[model samples]
Structure formats: structure tokens, C-alpha cells
Target: MAEETVSCPVKIHMTTEIFQEETEKIELVLFGHYYEKGGSAYLKYEEMQEAGKIHTVVKVASGRALVMRSGAVSMRLDLREGSRRPGTYENGYGQFPIEAAADEIVHTRTGSLSGQLSLGYRLYMHGDSVGTYKMKIHYEEVQAAK
Candidate 1:
């Protein structure tokens, strides 16, 4: 038997916290599509910010995750526990070197269509430590109306 790709509309709730001089928290609710292929799961969503619209994609595997964003703000983040990944961030102004050192990455599935992902990492920009950050995402499939 071959594994088939499964795709569905999903609703996502995300919370992010940054620990710098002070802790800052941000939350967002987004609607998108969730799909599973091979042995990996992926989430695709769009976010509207003051800058403009940003498209985001997240891929979760065994012990690692990849996040990619494009539009007004663009960046690719590869997070793996106990390792530092180098990437770049670009916006209206310019592009800057960025890196992420992941301390923890936990992904849990409550059901076939519902799960949660949590990440704890340290962010560096321009070779300088920016801050420690925690991000949590919960996603569930949307049911079609009868």
C-alpha cells in the first residue's frame, strides 16, 4: 500500500513570546490548509500585518521543523534541537543575517486532524543575540457545513 497525501482546511491559533529586556507576547488566529505527505505534516497560512500580506508555510518532521515566510516580510527558519541554523530575513528595508538555536521542539497529535507544536529557541540577528523566544501553534481541521 502507498501512503496518500491528505489535505483539509484548518484553523490555527498561534501564540508567540519573546524574552528580551521584557517579555512580549503576540497571538494570532489564522485560517489555512493542512496536509500530510509521506511522513511529514505541513501547514500553509496567510497573515495580514501593517506591512502587508505574508504567506507562511510550516513543515514538521520527526525532531525538526522548517518555517518559510514570503511577501512584505520573508524568511526561512530551520529549527532542530541542539543545533543552530543560519538563515536570512528580508523586509522592505533590506536583508539581514539571522540564526536560530533551538532548545526544544515538541510536536503532539491529539487526533488525525488536530495537533499542537511548540518551539523554544534563541534568535540571533547580525551575529548578535536578539532574544529567546517561544512559539506555540494549535491547528484543527475545519468541518464542512452540511
Candidate 2:
């Protein structure tokens, strides 16, 4: 059977907390697409700023999920539940090593990939615990492509 394609209009809000003291927040609105392929659900979105850009892809299969971010982040971060991945978050300055670890990831692993996603994780730079983060995403299906 062929996979059904749908448009996903999403709102993402992310908050980062550092050392139990500081917090940083980012909110973005972007459009992506959703499709089922090879028994997995895939979501792709491109995120771009004036100087930075990246593509975010979320893949879910068998009640497990991975969030991959590539391009302008200067590196590809493959994030899985309770797993730590080493990568880089880039800017105009240069690239720096970043370790992203997720402790709790909440999502609907089966069925249509819509609604909310909550990721609780921490960031480490130079082996020091720099911050913890929470990311929330809400995705809805659009009937038609724009």
C-alpha cells in the first residue's frame, strides 16, 4: 500500500534550564509534512533564521522515536529516549561539541503523528552539566498542501 501524505503545521516551544538556575526559551512556527514509509511515521520540517538554518525530522516506529536535526545546527543530532548523543550546535562563530541526553520522552508512537511532544533532556559541554531542557511540539494535519 502507498503511504498517505499530509501537511503538518506545527508550533514548537522549547525551554532550556541550566544548572537549576537559568532558563532559555524558543518558540517557532513552521510547516512540515507527514508520511508513513516502511512501517514508520516521518515528519520533516526546515528551520531557518537569518544566519542559521536546520532541518528537523522525527521518525517513529514500534513505540520508539528519534528526533534528528541537521543542516545549520552544523551537526546532526540523533536523539532517542534515555540516550545521550554527541553533536554540535552551530552559529556564525563556529562549532562546539554538545551532548544531548533525554531522560523522558513523551509522544504517541502509534497512529497519526499529531498533538504534543514533550522532551526532557540535558545538555553537556566540555563534560560539564550546562543545562536541562524541555521541548514541546504541537502538530496538526492540514487538509491540503499550501
Candidate 3:
């Protein structure tokens, strides 16, 4: 696949404890880099929240390491469970409560990390009922254009 450059503004909030007991002070950082299937970048700072503790809201930077702005990003995931028989599409739209769980990862020049994060969303299914789904995403903060 061709290389595509995209800026991702990541905001991480932790409420768990790092390691086994000690609390942590989270430091959010923004970095600018080119992302590819097998590419990586570095963090502006080395200090981060404790290894296993959780943090409230950690502001990583003034805005984006590459730029600064206020915006919103949304990712949609569609899970297709195997049908009972076959040739039958079991897809409907309505009010579905979606429960998504995601984790944060920092792909630095040195290495990559995998953490545990919990996320939730409301999926609209049929009628007033909703579907709760799970989600897992790995990304990092990036710089925004000035």
C-alpha cells in the first residue's frame, strides 16, 4: 500500500494504578511522524505516567506536536457474526447501545507498547433497542499544522 501521512491527536485518560500499588502522574505528549505499516516515531519527552497506574486527564501538548487545533475524530467498526445458515444478511439499523473497549499504544522509534483501555458507544439498531459492541484501537498523538 502507498504511504499516507495522517496526524492523530491522542488524548489518554487513566483511572487505574500502574504496577501494583503506586499511583501515577500522567504526562501526555504529542509527536509528529510518518505512519506506515512498519514505521514508527519518537516521543518528545521520555517521562510518562507510572508503568501500571491510571491517571485522570493528561494534556500531552499545547495542541498537536505538528499543529494546534480543536476537533473530533470518529472511527466506526462493523462486526459481522457468522450467520446461522447462509445467504442471509443479518444486518439492521435501530437504536443499539454500543459498549466499546480500547487500549492506548505508543509506537516510538525504540519500540511499541500495548495497554488496556475501556471504551463505550451507542449503536442504533432496530426500534428503541441498541447494540453494545467492543472496540480496540492503537494510536498516538501527532502534531497539527499551525
Candidate 4:
């Protein structure tokens, strides 16, 4: 029998609508963890606002993957967005890259058909005066999904 395998990169873009109750500076973190090494990744949202560069990362498949017919994958991420850099108040947004290594986790009895993931970032008022700012992170696909 001939064997076949498929590989591709997954991209996720999310936008959030928040209401600021207090006028305080806030910092946020966004990340996602899956059943794969490096499957877990995160980015500093506050940095994005200051540098005007998008913080993103690439997720690699776990080398020690169990061959299964069907299963599920879970992911977790934080939606908080703000700036935390010192001596700056210029707000911006951008994307960055993420990477995952192989053989990071060693635990395999049976290749279950289910997968779970958890990811999120922290939000803290790192510097400056207090104020609230509503932010939304928009994603644009540069690479074609195959």
C-alpha cells in the first residue's frame, strides 16, 4: 500500500472590542498551547503597540506524533491588548513569528485521537499614567494556505 502524508501551516487572526472603565495603562499577552512541542507559543501584545511591529510565531508539528484516524485539538489565548514599554506612549500594532521544537514532551502509551491546547498572555500597566484604551488586533494572510 502506498503511504501519503500532508503538511501545512495554520494561521489565526482575531479582533477584540474592549471597553475601558478606568484610564490606566495596561499590558497584554497572547499565546496558544497545543499537543505539539513549541505547540505552545506566546507574544507580548504591549510590545506590538510600541514598536509598531506585529508579534507572531510559527508552530511546528511534534516529531513524536501518534498516528491516529480522528482526534481533536484545543487552543487557549488572551485577548488583552495594551502598551507596557517604558518612556513611550506611542501605540501601534503588528505581527510576529513562533516556532516549536521536537521531542519536547516524553509521554506516550497510546496515540489518542484527541488533542488539547492552552494559550494566553499577561496584561499589566507597566508604566506611565492611568488610562483605558480599546484595541483590536487584525491579521492579514501573507502566505497562501495549502
lDDT (Cα) of model 4: 0.26
C-alpha RMSD values across all candidates: 1.8, 3.8, 16.4, 14.6
Candidates' C-alpha lDDT: 0.92, 0.66, 0.27, 0.26
Q: In candidate 4, which residue ranges exceed 4 Å CA deviation?
A: 1-7, 22-35, 38-51, 58-122, 126-146
Error of 2 at 40 (Å): 3.4
Candidate with more favorable, higher lDDT: 2 or 4: 2
- Ranked by lDDT, the better of candidates 1 and 4 is 1
Per lDDT, the best of the predicted structures is 1
Candidate 4 residue lDDT tens string, 72-114 = 2111222212322222112223222212122122222122212
User: Candidate 2 at 86: error in angstroms?
Assistant: 2.2
Question: What shift in Å separates residue 9 of candidate 4 from its native position after superposition?
Answer: 1.5
> Best-fitting candidate, measured by TM-score?
1
Judging by lDDT, tell me the better candidate of 1 and 2.
1
lDDT tens digits, residue span 53-143, model 1: 9999998898898899999999999999999999889999999889999987888988888899898889999788999999999999999
lDDT of 1 at 121: 89
Winner by TM-score between candidate 2 and candidate 1 = 1
Off by over 4 Å in 1: 1-4
Name the weakest run of 10 consecutive residues (lDDT summed) in model 3: 62-71
Per-residue accuracy of model 3 over 15-38 as CA lDDT, tens digit each: 322322343333333222323222
